[model samples]
Target: MPRRASGPRLYLDKKRRQWAIRDGANFIRTGCPEAKLEWAEKLLAKYIAAKYSPPKSASPPIADILLFYLKDRVPMMKSRSAKYNVANLEKFWGDKLLSDVTPANCRAYARTRSQSAARADLEKLQSAINHWHSERATLPAIPKVWKPPRNEPRDRWLTVSEAARLVKASKRAEHLKRFVLLGLYTGSRAGVLRTLEWSWIDLEAGTMRRRAPGASEVANKRTPPIRLPRKLKHFLRRWKVADGGQCKYVVHYNGQPILRDPWRSWKEACKAAGLVGVHPHVLRHTRATWMVQRGVPPWQAAGYLGMTVRVLEATYGHHSPDWQAEAADI
Candidate 1:
């Protein structure tokens, strides 16, 4: 038996070193050079839309709607995971029509992904549909994109002793040490730390700006400026002199920015400290836990940690000695 023929898809023309759309025996050139893959993808989306998208009043193929959203909306997103979420969603929903988004199908999608991950992916789907609807003057009633229940916030945080051991173990690697210290003291997410530059640190003002200039400000993943801890300030000052003001990024290897997470060195540090299953984000959790244990006010701690007060209280408030003191007295 012969294999079935595939439909229009992206193909690299190795001879010309450019992207093209393969449609049966013919190739439609994208006019996009090798370096401009995103542009090629956008052009391909236009091709798919022109060919497969239904009339304005009818429900459209899931792929066409998603591709339209990808072309129009995703470019403005601040989240790094947006493209991956869209790709995963496309895999399951590509051939399906918008009318097929039923509760049963949504649950099937959930079963294939982790609880939290499924929720996130479905949320993206929901957003894409909403975006599509908003742009259209008329269409069928939007199908609901069901999602799994939200998972409880993770409870894993390090003890003071464990944090100390991890930091000490990290001392073997200069970049890892700085990464750990900044994570523990400032409670910034790993992404912020990865992109942190020396220019964001203000030793004289005793503050550190977590967000890069001109980066889109995301409400959920806030990156508010925080005052530097006295100890952390001293470390930064010393590191500045040691680096001789040559490095651009704070968490750099040989004065060059790390293109990816320092997972190998981080895992080694964790192993040397006799810790397991403790990823980098745990350091931020540990800092929040410590502050709550010390009876820090939720608003103040939330501000310093670049999270909302409601989130801080919901996740770590129980650690406070005075938590529910008045209510529990009964």
Candidate 2:
């Protein structure tokens, strides 16, 4: 086996007085030290060319971007998954003007949420704030808010027995049963389930695709799918829909679209299940962790769950510590 390249690279075609770029993937595949170093040097030169290039409109007020995000950018979004971002952003940054929306302010907002008693929830908020901040702009020279250097991902994993109980409890909530089971089995975000249209599910292939936010409601967008568990497939088969897949969910309430925050139901379920403070996201965390605990690869878990590995580490990694630590044992 050969060593992998550390990063991307650029090559100087001095003979032609030009530069050529090679990527991390290429150098990684080559797996030679010289190739890796060559790639790194090229990457450095490319970085010099790309650095300090200001946006056409420098310093657009935070208020403007946020307003654009909310009134237009957010509402127009078709994915139910993205609504969570809107809601989270509203919870944190809704009241402030864009000029007041410094990276520091975002960090402070995350910090405040992190200060909550839910050891796991605090980190969840920090991670989410960071996600919202990661869009297009270059990071600020100094963040007004700073994330403390600590790895305190909350423990949201459910024991198999606990999962069984939650699955049993879900039966009592007619509208939410399938949704809860989907969370337990698939570990997808609640928002995605809430806004999922029948159009998104590829029944034959057994995949649930995601349509990223900001695309047209009728636009041709592609969201990768997850393989449907057999139980989930049965649930979908028995599931009824209106003439078109226009209904709001895989489950419903009062024959109208069910619209309730999942947290409320999760809380009630925890109480009934003889548990406490079991956040809805915790259910998601638990499901993903179950995969890792069972020796599933993080990359597989991440792709199935639609999160990055960096994210899996910071958010769901708490449960995998023992598994990860055993590399020493190996």
**Backbone clash count for every predicted candidate, in the order shown:** 0, 10
lDDT of 1 by residue, 178-260 (tens): 99999999999998898899888899999999977776678888899999999999999899999997889898988888777
User: For residues 1-330, could you state the per-residue lDDT of candidate 2 as single tens digits?
Assistant: 988865555555545444455555542222224435665565566454443232322344443334334443445555454445445555665555434645566556666554432223323333433433555343343123344555556775788888888877777776667777877887876666666666677778887765533543332332346888888888787675332455655656655655665666666777778777677776678888887777677888887887777787677665664746777677
Q: What value does the lDDT take at residue 264 in candidate 2?
A: 63
Q: Which 10-residue window of candidate 1 scores lowest in summed lDDT? A: 49-58
lDDT of 1 at 229: 94
Model 1 misses residue 151 by how many Å? 1.2
Q: What are the lDDT figures for the candidates, one per model?
A: 0.88, 0.59
Error of 2 at 260 (Å): 3.1
**Model 1 pairs whose backbones collide:** none
